[model samples]
Target: MKTIPTLSLALIGALSLSACQDKTAAPEDIRPVRYAVAGGNAETGGARYAGEIRARNETQLAFRVGGKVVAKLVNSGEHVKKGQPLARLDPSDYQLDLAAKQAQLAAAQSDLAQQQLNLKRYHELLAKQFISQAQVDAQQNGVNAAQAKANQARAVLDASRNQTGYATLTADADGVVSQMQAEPGLVVAAGQPVARLSQDGAREVAIQVPENALEAVRAASSLRVTLWKGGAPLPGKLRELAADADPATRTYPARIALPGDSHGLQLGMTADVALPAQASRQLSLPLTAILDLQGKHYVWVVDDKTLRVSRKAVEVGAIDSDNAAIASGVRAGDKIVTAGVHLLHEQQRVKLLGQ
Candidate 1:
């Protein structure tokens, strides 16, 4: 056998190295993706959230001024009429202040009366040429000054009288007392919640909705509220939806307005609020599956046999924070890439991450 040249051996070695690299080339990456079957969410009939019955006009009742509470006249759950006295503070000091203001006002009025008499006498003296015109003007100025002081004292007396009334707490509207926080001896600051007053008015159901369901709940035309006390579901309308989410719960607080009768719904009663579902048989997908490109909505449809992903434009109807209803462009049985859709392209091989 003839020995090969050194350059040819080197050339053969390079070819062998290239072949090995080709054999070890990274397998075409088949990205693993999380997916969901269309219309697979079990709560499709309606989304029910646990909630509580609440007053549409609940308010915190507190005193305008700080004082020792002398009495709490009502208990929780007691119905009260407008202008009814609910509680009272010690009014001894307030009354004393009012009396002092009265005394000040009385003294000021007496001084003003004396000043007016002096001005009258001075004007008569000027008319008889017994006093200079300048003296009459001076006396008139004194009367004006005294009158101003009397008016100020009168205003102060009125404020002092009002303060005495502040010692007693009265209901601003007809309502039920849902809670009482002050007792006979409790000293509270001004504006401290002494009681919770649920004004008699329209009733409501208070519920917390997850971020994903916020929009759907807000857009709901009407809902059914079932109290834990076991009665027929009450009809309600979406009244208020919080714009921001709660920090601790990460959920939005929503209130559904019920009629004034609402079958005598009691405040703080546990309840269930059910949002109306979408149209019959309409498929919905997790909001994550939606892909919006150039103002058009799309979704990644996965082929079962080939495990390949194909981007398809979809008709997106109502969309909540959690899911979007599909009007067209996909079927009920089609598998959809729920997550990692933005990272995918047309006709890409994929692996299902167990549903």
Candidate 2:
């Protein structure tokens, strides 16, 4: 019984020693801390918009007469000058018709010549009393009839020639061939588009603006367009605003004319546009500072006194080439985590790198 009491005393002494060791352990060993620096506000200028580049004029090249295509001289993306032959239909039928009309014209001319001679002879005979007045009148009528037939034949010849010319499709303007819908041996109808041509001229950036954003866009006086390829921003003027919104997207179409030569620009190229909202001093930050969880967007901000992280929900406005505009949720003098936000949580302690 005395041995059991001694063993119990020993166990109690060991438990007290373990409690003292736990109190002496370093706090850093229990929870590790990381340092994060706050991001400084960046100056933002305007709202950046994205849109597609388009040519000022586009046309469809098609044959004027229906026939089987004999040859397609041009392909898509081929640059063609005005009057260049784009395609040709079979002209054999048209050529035969023209030949037939020519032959008829020749016969009509011979008949007209014969009628003229007869009418002259009749006039001379009537002058000498060799023919009666009725005979001369009949001869004159015959001459008029022959002349009318000659005129009809001439018209038919001209029409046949025109039809022959119509077999060849030509470009109406200098442009790049954007599409080719027909090939050799394909039978195409008159006025059916065989190719699409995009005329070279002033280029515009076409953008679809949400209906709710139209008021703000109209209120702005000017906007700047930045080519994705990088250079000086081209000054833009609002040329047109659609009267109605698109039924499918519920957005209004807006077009901006870009000043300067658009020689290098091509259709479907993407461009970035910047529109200035009300000019006011606001806090802007790099896009890296923004974070997303589920569908909500937030930013990690540093507490001035505790040096701990605070998650703040922010309303983001527009994004430009480098930064994003913060409409709400952040203010000046607040230090925002610029990097390593993925490793942070609410109320997490952090040590400043420099401090």
Candidate 3:
């Protein structure tokens, strides 16, 4: 019985030693890290900018002659074709002036015929020496004077006819009548604007960019334009940059050309333009890897030897789709925390979840 008890005690001690050894040898539990993965790739920066849709060509239609507007053939928002009649002035005054000129021209023609006959008679008499040379010379002078008067009268007649034609206003090109400045019975001055015509053709988007961003705008390759109705994004090429900044707002204007048929687009419609930001080869990482604290952006980077994490400040450039482009602070080859960045703090020790 004594030997059995001693053997039992020895067995219990060995088991207790084994249990302690097992406890010491066991591996520590590693917390699983949840992360989102993003690949570094070429991406375009998207920015929403307000813009205006404008016609490629717009012209002011005016009258050539001043008169009472007798009739207005077109109204605002009306489409007009080339050579279409837009408005007409009172033709009564112009018609009377033309008729009077015609009458004067007829009288001048009759006088010219009579003068030619008198000149013929005078030359015949001078050759025969039947009449005095002084008398023949006087008749020739009268004939010359009559001919000059006839010519002047004919010129006057033609001018009156031309004035008559100027009473009507016509469109010089195909366009839509955007504005009407004249109404019936309205007396307008010569060369006064009668209507505003917008030519049917290409469309452009005008955007105002900050003066400080002018340098980046000049370096950008292209811009993105979006239509308001469908929110459709279309590629637009940079066409022109304003020479001077706006005095009131301190912004530079930029014009971009939108491709495709512009017939459906109305003048003065609003557009959204995305201007390219400064080009930079940034360290792009997943959005989940970025942590926002105290209104500042930061990220977690891993230490290679110790497998620890440290928070670092980053200047973000553009959010390309889902990835954040890091302008500064992080390098290309740095091991960034793909997941579990929210759970990390400055100089926090960490173990690779999988490794």
The numbered model that scores best in TM-score is 2
**Candidate 2 vs candidate 3: which has greater TM-score?**
2
> Which window of 10 residues has the lowest lDDT sum in candidate 2?
29-38
Clashes of each: 2, 0, 1
Give stretches of model 1 more than 4 Å off: 1-43, 279-355
Predicted candidate 2 versus true structure: per-residue lDDT over 1-355, tens digit per residue: 3466888999999999999999887474112333233224345666667998877777977888999998989999899999999999999999999999999999999999999999999999999999899999999999999999999999999999999999998899998888987799999888998899888888889998887678777776778888887777788878888999999989888988888898778887889877874454556777777898888779988877987888999988766666677888977767777667787878887776531
Q: Each model's TM-score?
A: 0.68, 0.70, 0.62
Q: What is the lDDT of candidate 3?
A: 0.80
lDDT of 1 at 73: 93
Whole-model Cα lDDT per candidate? 0.88, 0.82, 0.80
Candidates sorted by TM-score, best first = 2, 1, 3
lDDT of 3 at 215: 66
Model 2: how far residue 258 lies from native, Å: 4.1
lDDT per residue for candidate 1 within 160-181, as digits (tens), equals 9998998999998999999998
Query: How good is model 3 by TM-score?
Result: 0.62
Residue pairs with colliding backbones in model 1 are 212-321, 212-322
